[model samples]
Target: MEFFNKTGKVAVGSRLRMLTEKITEDAAKIYEVYGIGLQPKWFPVFYVLSAGEEKTITAIAKEIGHSHPSVSKIIAEMGKKGLVAEQKDKTDGRRNMVSLTPKGKEITIKLQDQLLDVNAAIEAISAQTTHDLWKAIEEWEYLLEQQSLLSRVVEAHKKREAAKVTIVDYQPKYKAAFKALNEEWISTWFKMEATDYKSLDHPEEYILDRGGHIFVALYNDEPLGVCALVKMDDPDYDYELAKMAVSPKAQGKSIGWLLGQAIIEKAKQLGAKNIYLESNTILKPAISLYNKLGFKKVPGRPTPYERANIQMELDLRS
Candidate 1:
């Protein structure tokens, strides 16, 4: 009963239909009050014919922004009521020209006076709003022309789905995924070193067995990314956040952010005093992400991996 109010813009098509029905309903009442025996839907075609311009069905449809079949149906109904007549074009036998009959012209004359009142009533309603509804409609149509509503809707859907990515703890099924995902990114940027192979080849021995954790990002149960929190030998509570990688297809979807957050949270849960990571300066986006997660640059130190030229650390205590 109150679908328009409940759904609002989410159901724009339905709301527009409801608004049209309301206007048409009022117009029908106005017609009855003025003793005009005409339906509101017939007004457009009737007014066009009343201008004394004989038009073909295609021309009438184009002028009124309706389909040819719809205009033809209306013309047929008006013909039955003796308000309109269709005549074959002399020059083109296939074309039928439509014109108002004598009775239709008489009805148009009677309705002309009532039309002013209808126009005034509609204008009065529009004046009640702060913004002009008609002007807003024109702007909305122009915007739709520039970029269709369907395109905007599809973009919004993609964003929503991208945001829906989840960080999941490593499971037995994801054992190979943990290595494959990390290898995919590492091989793309730099060749995997012995240290990388040691950890990736034996995640259980080097990671899980050493009181560390691995977290994976999943979208609809498909593994998209992974990050590991390795317990340090110097400080039992310190963790090295490493081996982070997101699949190429899911790279731009913030799966990396989700994976980073999950590992950071895991570090906190493990009572980590600080989380450290090593990276190369060429990885600007990754560095930016680290900075966003409260990682601050620290003095560079000798690292096992040749590619490690930058060092950063997040002090959880502060």
Candidate 2:
């Protein structure tokens, strides 16, 4: 009777749901102080309320990506809890309109405040991490939306499509080649002189050395770009970003931002509270990408690398 029984697809789907539930539980716990029943299942209702539209059950269900029947059941439950109410649609007696009660609206404001507090706390932990979190969320949302669109297309013949990647680890085989590529990239892409060879080590060695990682973009089986993470030994410093570059052929692809993102994720995974970068203002495009990725200007130590005339750092936890 269970069509999905023992299916790999079913298992994968269930696991994803379980992970989502766990995250939802954590968020709900954080927001519990607001005294609103802001549980995982109620997110659709809250989203509707925030959108501020009085809509029929069918319309609300479609907007929230749920079935009308399921949405109706949720509305009924919310009504019982005094969070929402349903009234017969004047234009269509068969349809019921849904709206948030005053209590629901009041609780939403508190939840918003709690969310802002969460952002601030994250930012307080690490500047590099703050930007990383936002970028990660942005990437996650982009992928989710992309997947949803692909799903719709597939349900109709099929359809498709692709990171500012943060660099985490470097490939030893590509080290010498990447270093050369990095130098070429800095000169060509950022119009800065390349200097300093801290020594030849495998990408893994550097990753472990810095308590971070590295990443490379490849084209035609050749290393085309690279980035890295360097942890701060001092508690006051948090972390530092280093050795990011992309080949001339890879220019205009925004691969640097992708490498930057990879670096951010690496730092986050390594338990870094903040991540800072050393760079120059003349690298306008790179700076713009960083800002778009949520990196803000902050006073910091100058780049020790001879070519870096400007230095910028980002808080990671936010």
**Best of the candidates, TM-score:** 1
lDDT of 2 by residue, 105-147 (tens): 7777777777688779767856755357557757967887878
- List the candidate 1 regions with Cα displacement exceeding 4 Å: 1-128, 132-159, 235-237
Clash count per candidate = 0, 37
Displacement of residue 217 (Cα, Å) in model 2 is 1.3
| Model 1: per-residue Cα lDDT at residue 217 | 86
Q: What's the distance in Å from true for residue 89, model 2? A: 61
Q: Over all chains combined, what TM-score does candidate 1 have? A: 0.54
TM per candidate comes to 0.54, 0.43
Across residues 1-318, which tens digit of lDDT does each residue of candidate 1 receive?
486667677888877897899888988998899888888899899988899988998999999989999999999999999999999998999999999999999998999889788789779988897889889999998999999998898778767877778887888789899999888878888899999999998998999999999998888889988999988886433889999988888855777777788888888887789999999888888999999999988988778999899999999999
